[model samples]
Target: MILYHTEPDSPVIEISVEGKITDHDLREAIERMRGDLELNGKTRVLERIEHFTGIEPKALWTDITLGVSVARKVTRAAVVADAVWIRASMHLARFFTKAEVKAFHVNELEQARVWINT
Candidate 1:
């Protein structure tokens, strides 16, 4: 599941993911982000992943394509996850995204929020 939090005229987008993610969920989230980018030109992202079991194969593909498509439009991305593998995956994702991507432990969510807001 994915939850998005954004306020009117805000340049920061907050997303929270839980459990398994599907291709539809990814596509919807990406589309919303694209719409925000169109209006804002550039934006920062704060993503929090909790109990993320995994994603479907098709979801992975959609994520890659959509992420690359909007790479240059994102200014910064802060990912908060406790899993080591998730952190490693964030590093790999950075190569495909233009945003400055950083991974934080769950305990450091406040710091991550500050970084993204800055």
Candidate 2:
């Protein structure tokens, strides 16, 4: 499941993920961020992984495609997760994205927020 918290008139989008993520969830989130980027010109993202069990193969593909499509429009991204694999994946994803992507341990969420906002 994916939950979005977008402030009105703000260029920053916050998303929380829980359980297994489906393709539909990823697509919807991408659309939402795209809308924000269209309106704000650019966007920063803060993703909090609460309990990510895994993502479906199709969802993973969709995520990659959509993310690359909007990479240049995203200025920064901060992913907060407890899992080492998740952090590693975020690091790897940075290579494919135009955004300045960073990973933070769950305990460093506040720092992530500050970094993304800056």
Candidate 3:
């Protein structure tokens, strides 16, 4: 499951991923994000992966497509995660985004928010 919320004070869009994240979740998230990007002009993305366990290859592909779409539109991307693999993946993928990608621990969500807002 995925839930999306917009930051009240900024153009940052936050997404929460819980339970199983399927390709459908990725697609829906991307669609909402695209709408947000168009509305915000200068966009930022915050993604929180809390109860998300694993993603399938189709989901991964969707993720890449969404990331690329965000890269073309957003000013920054912040990801808060406890999963080591996800952190590593973000670090590796950072180079592709036009926006900066920063990964933080769940406890550092505030810090991630600061970075994205900045």
Error of 1 at 70 (Å): 2.0
Candidate 1 clashing pairs, residues 3+ apart or interchain? none
Output the lDDT of residue 7, model 1: 85
Q: Write the per-residue lDDT of candidate 3 for residues 1-118, one digit (tens) a residue.
A: 8888986556988889877888887788888888777777888888898867778789888878675766678777888987877777886665667778889989999999888878
Predictions: Cα RMSD each:
1.4, 1.4, 2.1
Model 2 per-residue lDDT tens digits across residues 1-118: 9998899998899999999999999899888888889999889989999777989999999978786787667889999997888888886775677788999999999999999999
Which residue pairs of candidate 3 clash? none
For candidate 3, give the lDDT of residue 91: 66
| Model 2 segments more than 4 A misplaced | none
Model 2, residue 45: C-alpha shift (Å):
0.4
Ranking by TM-score: 1, 2, 3
Ranking 1 against 3 by lDDT, winner: 1
Clashes of each: 0, 0, 0
List where candidate 1 sits over 4 angstroms from the true fold. Answer: none
Q: C-alpha displacement of 60 in model 3, angstroms?
A: 2.9
